[model samples]
Target: MIDIHSHILPFMDDGAADYDAALGMAQDALNDGISTVVATPHHANGVYMNPAGEIEESVRVLNAKLQEAGNPLLVLPGQEIRIYGDLLDDLERGQLLSLAGSRYILLEMPSSRVPRSMEETCHELIIQGYVPVIAHPERNAEVAEDPSRLVRLIELGALGQLTAQSVAGTFGSKLQKLSLELCRRQAVHIIASDAHDQLHRPFGLSEAYGVVKRELGSDAFDFFQQNSRKIITNEEVIRANPVQSYNKRHRLFGIFSRKG
Candidate 1:
């Protein structure tokens, strides 16, 4: 499996603290059956700034270390860029890194709220010939309250990636339910272990895949797996139909709720 989002680079951001920790994280990923991982350190996220060149170098160094340690996992370069006003400019200037150097970019929205210019920004990215992929939308507070916001983003040509921990109920039941709902509605395009460490943010890709297969089915699992691979290979991903908002009555009265 290919994990498109991770902070495994040493001393880059709030991910692995050092090379030892980074190697530990790689081992954990290997245990989870993930052979390929994108080292997506934070970039322009207000606190951390990881330029594309630096990220590429870090990936190179880490790959060498993995080879020395006899680990078969392959680490690729990427960035979890925060949505900012200069995103297009930076991307055009070759400062921003896409997922495994593919056309798909991992975009991170503020956790507190979706930016007011989000839709337009994503539209601009699409216009610029880049696929904007929203990372961990289920964890965004505003999006969790009104999932239709994400549905709208999807309608505008943006893809959504859910964190594996969220799907595995590691964050909480509410987020797990919301993640499942997004999958059922076909709003989610990928699943990634936004793993930060060996302990707290361990790789849960296999566990999350189990949950998706059990709850959603084999087809859902295949869809997510194929899309993830496609993104890394710069292939055009298969998109599902536009997602609709869940009925309010169903929320209040369970599955037996009648349409008004």
Candidate 2:
């Protein structure tokens, strides 16, 4: 499986602390049946600033470490860019890196709230021939309150990526419920292990896929896995299931349920 979002690069951000930790994360991912990972460290998020060139080089170094350690897992270049005013300018200046050089780019919104300009930024990115993928919307407080906000962005051509831990109920029951609801509504297009470490934020891709298959069924499982693969290959992502706009009020009264 290909995990499109991860922070496995050493000393880049709040991910792996060192090369040893990075190798450990790679081993964890390999054990989870993930053969490829996009090393998307935080960029322009007020603290760390990893440019395209630096991330490319960091991925190379990480891959070399993995190879030396006889690890078969592959690490690719990416960035979890927090949207800012001059983001388009940075993209034009070749500062931002897409997932594995694909047209799909991983974008991060503020954790607490979805920025007001998010929809417009997504539209602008689409116009520039880039696919904007929002990372971990289930964890965003505003999105959790009103899922329609996410559905609107999806309708505007943005893809939502649900974190594996959220689906596995690692964060909490509430987030797990919301994650499942988003999946049932087809609001999220892919599942990725936004793993930061082996202990706390470990790779849960296989386990989360198990939850998806059992709770949502085999078709949903296949749809998410295929989209992950398509992103790496730069192929057209197929959304076979029709998306449903989420109704927050109805969700509490049997709007979401386990497969019977």
Candidate 3:
């Protein structure tokens, strides 16, 4: 499996703290059958700001250690860029890091809600030649309540990724079911570990795949694996023709709730 988003870079952010922790996280992924892990440290998240160049260096050092340890995991440099106004400019000017120097960029938004300007920002990124992939939209309350709000992004040619834990019901049944719904509708593109540590948020993606396979079948398994591989290769992941969504109830609820 190719983990498109992760915070396993040592001392880069609030992820794996040191080289030991980073290697440990890699081992966790390796044991789970993950071969390539994109070391996506938080960038411009208002607290942990890992610059693109610094992240590249961190990956280089980590790769050396992995080689020395004879671990078969490949680490790549990427950034989980928080949604902000100046994203396109920062990326174009070489201030933002693409996924291992590819056109694919992993994007994260605020937790509670989807930003109003997010759709426009993604469109702008598309215009500027970057694929803006929203990370972990399943955990967003607004998205969970009304998943069709994400359809606008898909219409604009942007892709969506879900947290592996969310699919496993680590958050709750609402989020877990919503994530599967997105996959069923072909709205979700990739599933990533987004691991922080081995205790609370350990790197465990295999079990999540098991859940998906149980609920969604082998096709869903292939979807997550194939699409993640494409993102690693910086290739276009066209949606499996948009399915009919069972979202009319959600649309009505959203409308009635907003009438206050």
Candidate 4:
């Protein structure tokens, strides 16, 4: 399987702390049946800044190490860029890196809220021939309260990627339920392991796929898996029917009132 999002580059961002930890993360990914991973360290996320050229170099070194270790895992370059005002400018200036050198970009929104200019930024990126893939919308507080926010973004030519841990209930039952809901509603286009480490944030791609297959079906599983492959190869992905907007008041009340 191809994981389009992961912070597996050592000494980059808050992911693998050193070379040893990065190798361990790669091994964990292999154990989870992942053959390819995009090393998407944080970029312009207010904490870490992994430039495109630097990210490419890191991927090269990591891939060599994995090859020497006989892991059979391929590490590709990518960036989990936080949505910012100068995103387009940076991309033009060669500061931002797309997913595996494809036109697809993994965009990260603020955890608590969606910025007011997010839609505009996404539209601008689309106009500039970049496909913005929103990362982990299910975990965003605003999106959890109103899923239509994500649906709207999808309608705007932006894709959504759900994290494997979220789907497998690693974060919590609430996030797991929300992730499942996104899959059921066809609001998510891809499922990836946003793995940061081997212990706390281990790769759960296989488990997530099982959950998707059991809860949704084989067809859904195939769709997500195919999309991930398409992303790395720079091919057009298959999108399901647009998600229907839910009644915000009813959905929010039910979501909060559900028994754990």
Each candidate: what lDDT?
A: 0.89, 0.90, 0.83, 0.88
TM-score, predicted candidate 2 vs. hidden true structure? 0.93
lDDT tens digits, residue span 1-260, model 2: 99999999999999999999999999999989999999999999999999999889989999998999999999999999998988999999999999999999999999899999999999999999999999999989999999989888888888999999999998999999999989877788999999999999999999999988888877678888999999999998865232432334444222233556
What is the full ranking by TM-score, best candidate first?
2, 1, 4, 3
Query: Stretches of candidate 1 above 4 Å error?
Result: 243-260
- Of candidate 3, the 10-residue stretch with the lowest lDDT total is 251-260
For model 1, residues 96-146, the per-residue Cα lDDT tens digits are 999998889999999999999899999998998889999999999999999
lDDT of 3 by residue, 161-227 (tens): 9899988998788788888888877778888999988777876789888888777777668778888
Error of 1 at 84 (Å): 1.1
The superposed Cα distance between candidate 4 and the true structure at residue 111, in angstroms, equals 0.4
User: What would the TM-score be for candidate 1 when compared with the true structure?
Assistant: 0.93
Q: RMSD of candidate 1 to the true fold?
A: 4.5
Better of 2 and 3 by lDDT: 2
Deviation of model 2 at 222, angstroms: 0.7
- In the order shown, the candidates' Cα RMSDs to the true structure are 4.5, 3.5, 6.0, 4.9
